[model samples]
Target: MAQQARAVVTRAAIISGAAAVFQQRGYGSTSLADVCAEAGVTKGALYFHFDSKEALARAIIESQHELSSAIGRDLVASNMRGLNAMIVMTLEIADQLHNNPVVSAGVRLTIEAANFASPVDAPYLDWMKAAEVFLRRGQVEGDITETVEVCSAAHFLISGFTGVQVVSDVLTRREDIQQRLVEMWHMLLPGLVPTDRLADLLTLPERIRASRQAALGQH
Candidate 1:
């Protein structure tokens, strides 16, 4: 049991290191050696955890989703539906981006790398599958428009958020970026919300906006 715990710790350390390195150097430039060095593990140890750089990158992407799911798991548990839950989840994700730089970059890197011409791996497809599930949930609850293709919307939103992170330099100005993201989310949420709930769901807390501004001041 103790050894298994250590192994789990080591794998997490490796994935964290890979996220940072891939964030700095990008998917194309990052290598197994870089991950190993950053993780303070031997090549053999790194291989023991992840078979290759691709596998490490895939793990990083999965970790990002796991972290995000944890953030909004409450809404899921509460059976919150429609735009309200989506809004809450979106805000939570934006806050997460502010809080976790490497994971933010990992998300961006995953999308950026997926644009390649060649066939991609299963993990990349899994990321898209997860997004589809989120959007489908919204649609089933009558939040998202039935005509709207959830997968495409998910891709566009992910791509746009990646650009937001790059433009604002999330690491330096997290709050500012987060506020912009929230505003963007608000603008789009109405389209997804049922007409009856639009007005009420759109009314976010003034304190939330104020708190974001205050966070910007600190940065």
Candidate 2:
């Protein structure tokens, strides 16, 4: 049992270290040697867990998707209204992109996937589906207008958020991503939300930030 636990810890360390390297260098520019040095692991140890750089990148991407999907699922299970949940989920993802090395690397690799031998599309598809569910529910509950097409709205939200993060990353290293996301919602909500609900929904981004800070303080 101890051996297994140690292996798990080692593997996690390798992944975390590789994520940081990948985040810095990107996929094509990164090498197994770079990962080894970053991880402070011998080549043999890295090979025992990941056969190649692509495998390591894929694992990081999958881990990122899992983290994001879990956030969306948890929000869905909560008592918050669907539109509010969607707002919070977007903010949560922005938070990850800003602070989580693994998620940041995964997103970078996924964007540059065509340069690699194997690319996974499921993560993008899964995220869109998750967002679509929230949008559909919001429309049904009248938190969003019936005129809004759920799938289109989902695509727009994801694409816009992705673009905003990329711009923020380049300009400010994502230091202002949370604020940029709030600004994005302000521009988008006018189309999706009723006038009466817009004021309430527009406040969600700040609330999400404050709530996260409070939770961190408690911990």
Candidate 3:
């Protein structure tokens, strides 16, 4: 039992270390030795948990997806208005990009996956599916216009958010990501949200930020 627990800890440490390295150097530029050095683990230890850099990256992507899915599930379970939940989820992801190295690296790796020779479309698909669910619910609830196409809107939202984060990362290392997301929603909501709900929904980005901060403080 002790050995199993220790192994779990070691694997987690290796993943975290690999994430930091991947975040800094990207998958193509990073090497197993880099991961080992970053993780303070030997090559043997890394191999025990992950066979190769591609495997390591895949694990990171899976972990990231799990965390993101959990957040979406929580928001859905809270009975929050779907459009509002979508806004909050977007902001939450931006916060993760800013504050969480694992998430940041996971996103970076997923984007550059083809370059690493380990193309992963699962994360993108998962995010789009989650967005589609929220948008469909929002439409039913009258927050989103009936004219809105949920799947296409989901694709658009994910693409737009991805672009915004990439630009923000290049410009400010994601320090300004939250603000950029707010601006993005401000521009997008005009088309997707009903006119009657626009004013209230516009405040969602700030509210999400405040709520995230409060939650962080509790921990």
Candidate 4:
């Protein structure tokens, strides 16, 4: 039992350390030795936990997806549904990019996925599916416009977010990501929401930010 617990701790530590390195240095530049040094574990320990850096990156991707799924579930359970939930979900992800190294690393690794052998597109597929669900619900609730094709809109949302975060990371290490997301929504909502709904939904970014601050125990 003690050995199992220790193994869990060791694996978690390795993941965290690898995440930090991967976020700081791109996948091609990062080495197993760097991960070992960051993790404060020997090469043998790292090998025991992971066969290669790509394996570590895949693990981080799994963790990132789980985190995103949890956010989706939480917002839905709290009745933050439809368009509002979808918009805030993107902002929340931007927050994770800013604050969570594991998620940040996940984003970087995903962007650099050409280095990997197998497909790394599942996270995106899942995200687009979730976006479709939100858009579909929003349309039924009369918030999203009837002209907006749910499937295309979902794909656009994910692609736009991907580009936005990549740009923001280059510009400000995602320090300005939430505001950028708000800006993206500003342009996007005119097309997606009814004219009357626009005014109310425009305030979502600030509301979500305030909620985030409160949750984080910030003033």
Evaluated against the true structure, the overall lDDT of model 4 is 0.87
The worst-scoring run of ten residues by lDDT in candidate 2 lies at 115-124
User: How do these models rank on TM-score, best leading?
Assistant: 4, 3, 2, 1
Tens-digit per-residue lDDT, 75-165, candidate 2: 8788777888888888888888888999999898889887677667876777788788888888888888888988888988888988998
lDDT of 1 by residue, 54-152 (tens): 777767767786787665566555665534554455556767766785567666665666655443354334434545666788788766778777877
Per-model CA lDDT versus the true structure:
0.67, 0.86, 0.87, 0.87
Q: Score residue 91 of candidate 4 by CA lDDT.
A: 82
Taking all chains together, each candidate's TM-score versus the true structure is: 0.68, 0.92, 0.92, 0.93
In TM-score terms, candidate 4 sits at 0.93
Which pairs clash in model 3? none
10 residues in a row with least lDDT, candidate 3 = 115-124
Error at 134, model 1, angstroms: 8.2
RMSD of each: 5.0, 1.8, 1.8, 1.7
**For candidate 2, what is the lDDT?**
0.86
Candidate 3 runs further than 4 Å off? 116-118, 214-219
**Total clashes for model 2:** 0
Which candidate would rank higher by lDDT, 1 or 3?
3
In candidate 1, the residue pairs with backbone N, CA or C atoms under 3 Å apart (3 or more residues apart, or in different chains) clash, namely none
Clashes of 3: 0
* Span of 10 residues, lowest total lDDT, candidate 4: 72-81
